[model samples]
Target chain A: MKKLIAVLTVLLIASALVFAGGNGESSGSGKKVVKIGVYEPASGDNGAGGKQETLGIQYANAITPTVTINGTEYEVQLVIVDNESSNDKAVTAASELVSKGVSLVLGSYGSGVSIAAADTFASAEVPAIGVTCTNPQVTLGNDWYYRICFLDPFQGTVLANYAKDTFGAKKAYALAKLGDDYSVGLCNYFIKAFEALGGQVIYETFPEGTSDFAAYVTNAKNGGCDVFYSPVSIEAAALIIEQANTQGLPMPILAGDTWDSNVVLAAAKGTNVSISVTTFFVEGSTDKQITDFVDGFKGYLASNATALTNNGGNDEIAAVTAMGFDAYYVALEALKKAGSTKGADIQKILPGVTYKGVSGDIAFDKNGDAVRNVAYVKKVDNATGKWQFVSVQSVK
Target chain B: MGFLQTNLPYLLAGISTGGQYALIAIGYTMVYGILRLINFAHGDVFMCAALMVIYSASYMPLYISLPLAIVATGVLGFAIERVAYKPLRTAPRMSAMISAIGMSYLIQNLALYVTGGLTKYYPPVPFISDSIEIFGAMTKRVTIITPFVTLVLIVVLVNIIKYTKIGIAMRAVSRDFETAQLMGVKINSVISATFVIGSLLAAIGSTLFFSNYTGVTPTVGGMPGLKAFVAAVFGGIGSIPGAVIGAFIIGICENIIKGLGWTTFSDAFTFVLLIVVLMFMPTGLFGEKATDKV
Candidate 1:
């Protein structure tokens, strides 16, 4: 009886191994499915970001040409991999995508993951187009890298302009999560810009994970700043804003696109002071292109068997849909111009192709950054749970 | 000095965080002192309590949510001891320890898979986010609530172990399970009760932790769990008071490092303290010597 059980166990183990091996090799040389890899946190704190980026790709593929990369035609496919919101996972995902023979990859909102996968993409000779993942090092140190978004310096200057001219705030306090590259980068950039604009950053602080904010809020109250800035997660932002409201602290809080979430609105609502955020798209806007993208994204989601529309995700989907549409069509237009799927061929032709995208007309600079549209700031209406357009400014 | 004064609230916040770690550490110390097998899965017990708090808060009022979560955690601790533990009571100590580690991984992964590893934000309470000022220092309502609640819990736990009948039984079991069983003190029941008390404390810790942290993730308990374990060893693995002291020390030390502008060193600071303590005192600050029936 024991021998029989051992045999069964071995067989089961063998079968499991076989199934795992098969799953990895299932994509045959069939229809020219161009497996584009995605590098984003499919789980953890930034899970929403992964879905947002991928969902954008989905809508772009739906509306754009059948296939185009460097002026050549080929069916497009995206092999989604979850970075689990860790840099280690990003490296693993990049390697896996390379092995799967993907020529292009999209991803990685934070600088850490982009850096992690830099060598992998470079070694594989595949291009990585970063979406809103801005830090100077993301594209500067690597050859096979590009980004559709502006860097921290640009974002910082835009925000500083709003603080100085828009809000008329001359003094501010900055609280940054020193542990993260994104937070530190954004904080430094904002301080430089704000200080240059003659606004004093009176006080600055950093704390570990979602701890009580009363002390910090009180400190901000003490510093007597007209504005308080924390480039933090939506979860952290909500708690801090809620506590700030509770303390009757009257400083206006300013932050990056990280503040663009329904939960932030939910937390800030009914509080004495309204929280404002900067980001790419505002959901409740009546702009023709903005509404068109939202409607198209919802339509695409409704048709796709696996598309999702929950957890304040439609807004996220709308943002990505715009980005993805730009990426896909740009690649297709490039492919038609190149008349080949070869990396070398397409790389040469990419500098010449131009297409007016959902965000703006896409044109790559010599350094490989898309010099497209500007980023806008939005305010959350606590009662309506919608984004109200506040202002638009260029990162440059 | 200006930076320190400006960031003093972060340090104070760290102290309150240390207080929560103390509560979780006590549970680890109490369990380890008697069993000599690390309750590796203690953090999951803490996570379960937080889950219970969120789930129960939906059905019951917010006031009742904490107690309900504590009770649920205690019940889970008892169940874990009864099912996964009791069968290995006669097994080798290493086997039990391995089982404990395996159970920890199982619980954490299960939570990760089920919760999709996302950070779940807690719905704000009516008056919980309010802040109070002391000596010109700002204290959040939850911080004030947490420290006082933790102190009260420590007192009650101390009283329960010092004067109660179950306390005597637990002590007897810790000394020698065989001897205690021979003396007609139900070994399983006493151990079960000990786990229950430890879990209840962990539950309270979790509730307080989530109240301040505002969100719970699969890996949220990882740092706290490992830190609480280090606290247990620092205080004396089997010593309850030792664990609490160890936790507070680790917490305070981490904050001091963070306050010093070496924020990247925050994760490593506590472990460095542990290594220093172990180098000087191997038995842990309060760990006892127990005989093994070889």
Candidate 2:
């Protein structure tokens, strides 16, 4: 009986090995495998945002399955890892991607994590294409890190200008989350630009892990500010929206790219406040290319309900997802232009490569940042229970 | 008058938040008193209660779900004590403490796994979350009710400890474990009762807490747990009244500091206050001086 049991165990182990081997060979039997690594936060503070970004990349991969390189077809496989939305975990996640031998990488929705993982990618010589991490330091001195979206400075200024032009605001309240690199950075830029536009600004901050915003909203109301600008994460934004509405602090609420979330939209439904944000993409564009992409993406989401949950349980397309979609196509274009799937080869070909992506016409400037001027302004139409496209503002 | 007008809202917020801290802190104190072991899992029990509401509120009606979730949380606390703490009772005190910590990690990671590290939206209870204007400060109804609820629970709990048979058994077990066993006290049942009461309070606390926040995350219990634990320590670790007072003091101080525009220093100020209290009083405001016989 013991011998028979041992024989069965051996047979099971051998079959498992055979199945694993069979799975590996079927993907690249006659084609070269080109890997694009996704380092995202599947858990942690920024997990929701990171999951949405991953969905966009996965959708793009589904649409464009293969890229031809040097008269040979290469299967594009995505190697994904969860960074847990932490700086320390980002280093480990980035190193894991490096070990996977991915030709290029697209990732990281949060700026702090992206900046944390930048050195790993730079040292490994693997060019990383950032989707929606808007902190300026991400691409400032790092040659290997390229972003497909505008930086916080531009986004902050656009928001400040929009407040001035649309609302005719003379006073603004700048609220941020303390110790957050993205919130503090964007808040400072907004203050500077608002002050430059001759608007009085009162700056305030709340500590991390704070679930309360009543005091801050009350402070803003009593301070006599016409506009409330809080560039915070989505979870915090949800609470702020609810409180601000209940408090009846009737001011135009403005934010940077992080506010472009369906979670925030869902929270803002039935609220009295007008929520607007400057972001990388808007779905209801008249541009045919964008319209086609949005339609196809909706169809993709229609079949995949789980994907919709990852995008905050709504059908609305997020700006970060659109940016993720564009970042994937951009990496593919660079890979095909290089005609070789080496890090250095793709990095060389990436400088001049441009693709009119689903989000926008993506072209890199001298600093490996997207040289785009237009920012989409979207507002939550509480009446319609949807995020409505307002207008596009250009940084002149 | 200007100062009073400006600071009234902050004071109310502090009181509401303080009540939450006290509710959670009482759990820490009571369990510590009975077990002579710092039950680190108490905070995670609070987190589980909040998550239970978020999940159950989706399918069940609010009225049924609220009571059902609280009872489930109480049962979870009871089970945790039985499985994790009860086995380590005969072993060294350190073993039970470590088990408590282990149970904490287990619950947190399980929450993380089940929720997929996503923040689940707390289904808004109609009247509990509605905002009402008081003294020109607009705040939720939960904020006003938290302190009164906490006070009523404390009075009822204190009376039980002073009078009831199970409560008297609990006191005896906390006073002397071996002697209580010799005197025919059901030591195991007493410990389980302690957990049940602690878990009930935590469930109630979590309902009020999540009502204000309106969103639940896996690590939601972590900060509040740490703060409540700090309140427990500051109030003299095993004393109930001390824990409640310590929580209120910390809550008020942090909010006032934040309202003063030093938002960055508010959290730091909490630790600083803890350190100062430790240095000065040593045993806390209402803590009894214990004499150890070697």
Candidate 3:
């Protein structure tokens, strides 16, 4: 029971934060304390993402104890709101963060979640940078919204191009989540790009979350497509991959950024499992910024260590934390260049400013997308238990 | 022939799932027949059984996990009866119903909290899943074993309920709890035993289900439990045999619909079938009225 409880504790820290979300009277904290809110799924479905985001925020705050804004140093205090990794909850967290009068908000770690929070940020005019949530809808409509990761269109193209150029895949099968707009959207984009690149998708099937995917895996295996592309929800991605491997189907399993998680990789590890994901950042890069993040995060956890015995040597590539470091870095850079901590001043220059961050050089386009097109394609190293970024595929 | 043979294994696998649904439904039917209340929390109990199975089985073979889960669930059922239902014996019907609903939510979310909401993989018994040809169809060993096991369990369960002393007490309680108590039968033990038996069957059913699916989720019991409740009601709720029949019909129909590529409406088909049966036979397929001898 305790082993189960320990695993659950690691997962449910955010849902506990969610209790904090609904209960606390709006502190209406003044701008003196640099409050940044994170909305992540803490308990259900996407709890891992939510928990990882907390780590990111804590690490970033440790490295930069106080954010210098317009020459005044404001100590960072992150107020987290658990979105339960749900779309509706993400919106609620965003509105709650605004109501609390935080200068900035970070998180809600998937594309669907970002879309849910988009309208609230648009109305409030707050700057946010998501970690691994790569949907285009997050940054497109809101002037105040931006992400540290690349968008779906580019990611879909990356997969499409990889299938074409690398595998020489003339025919592929698309297995996606039926009711999920995120899976369907990415699958559609990938199919469109693949066909345009002189490839063919012979068949496509949509499965519900409860649908046992073994049957569908068999169908794709029998379909004899050069590849099987399942743009799945983060929640269901690992299960689908596991079943695929168990069925002994040999098709290369390619998926979206939702595949970025330690549990997903660990489950997929050492099974000769090959999955391609366009991620925000890949580990093992010799970049100084990457090294600093690795060292700084390890230090933060070591200084606050309690449960080293629990993780069984699980490395920290938790999305929310890495994205948090980048988000704080982005915000800090904006403040440095603006020479003022005023929200209005920082918001104005955010679109054009460029800074080298953990993922890569960060430059927001007019639509608030990163101006650069660097997408890290990584496969899990079953031996090393680390994600090694293969060729850095640039789509621009 | 290749297409038929290729798909036969999957189709047979579907039957394995159907078998568990039927077993769990027997409990629902037996409970429903004696007590008109549908135990919504039965699914949550199944979810609880799954957590126990995962934890207890990690240190031993899965063959050991099945009995451990069943016994644990039975104990849980006894506890549930004492804590959640016994006090509400004289409460309003609405109150009991509300309590059951609340219990269902509590158990499920607690599981979501306890299990970290991640799916746990339980691989099959080694070398047990090799396929064999039958009627020009290739099927896994599980597909061959599940139906026979389900039938044997059903027979054994039915025989005990019909012939045993406790079975007589259960039958007497179902007819009239006060009268049975007047007859010096221990009413509390009978009710607790009934619930214990029901939970035990569900644990067994869900274990078979996980064997085929290779995992159990917090929500795994939700749909299966609902269908079992429906099965119980369909088979003349209180009648143990009726629930088994109801289970088969629902299980076979669901798989056939999925097999036909009309999965979008598979759930609708079961509900429609249940509705049609309830409209004409409100008392269910095998229900009998209790006649008073004054």
Q: Highest TM-score: give the candidate number.
A: 2
Q: Per-residue lDDT of B1-294 in model 1, one digit per residue for the tens?
A: 555545666666767777889989988888876776788889888887777777677798977877777888999999888877889989988888888888888877887776665556654555655556655555566766766777788888889888999998888888887798899998777888889988988887886677666667666677788888888889888888888778877877776665554555676777887898789887787777434544
lDDT tens readout by residue for model 2, B86-178: 888889888988888899999999999999888887888889899888777778899899999999999999999999999899889888889
Give lDDT tens digits, candidate 2, residues A36-107.
999889888788889989998999999898998898888999999999988888998998788768888897
lDDT at position A80, candidate 2: 92
Per-residue error (Å), model 1, residue A394:
3.7
lDDT by residue for model 3 (A117-176), tens: 877876776667666667777776578787777777888888888877777888888876
lDDT of 3 by residue, B1-294 (tens): 777755764566566666777778876666654555677789878778877888877788877876877899999978887887778878876777788888888888878767665555554554444445576653456666877888998898878888999988888888887788899998788878888988898887766666556555677678788877777777777877778777777777766665565555667777787898789886678866435442
Residue-by-residue lDDT tens digits, candidate 1, A156-208: 77888878876799888777765567778888999999998888985445544
DockQ of each: 0.32, 0.60, 0.26
Docking class of 1: acceptable
Clashes of each: 16, 0, 8
Runs of candidate 1 exceeding 4 Å displacement: A1-31, A62-65, A68-75, A199-219, A283-289, A299-321, A342-345, B1-15, B56-68, B82-99, B125-139, B181-185, B248-269, B281-294
| Leading candidate by lDDT | 2
TM-score of chain A of each: 0.84, 0.91, 0.84
Clashing pairs in 3: A41-A84, A41-A85, A53-A320, A56-A321, A70-A340, B29-B232, B33-B237, B33-B238
DockQ pick, better of 1 and 3: 1
Off by over 4 Å in 2: A1-30, B1-5
TM-score of each: 0.85, 0.94, 0.86
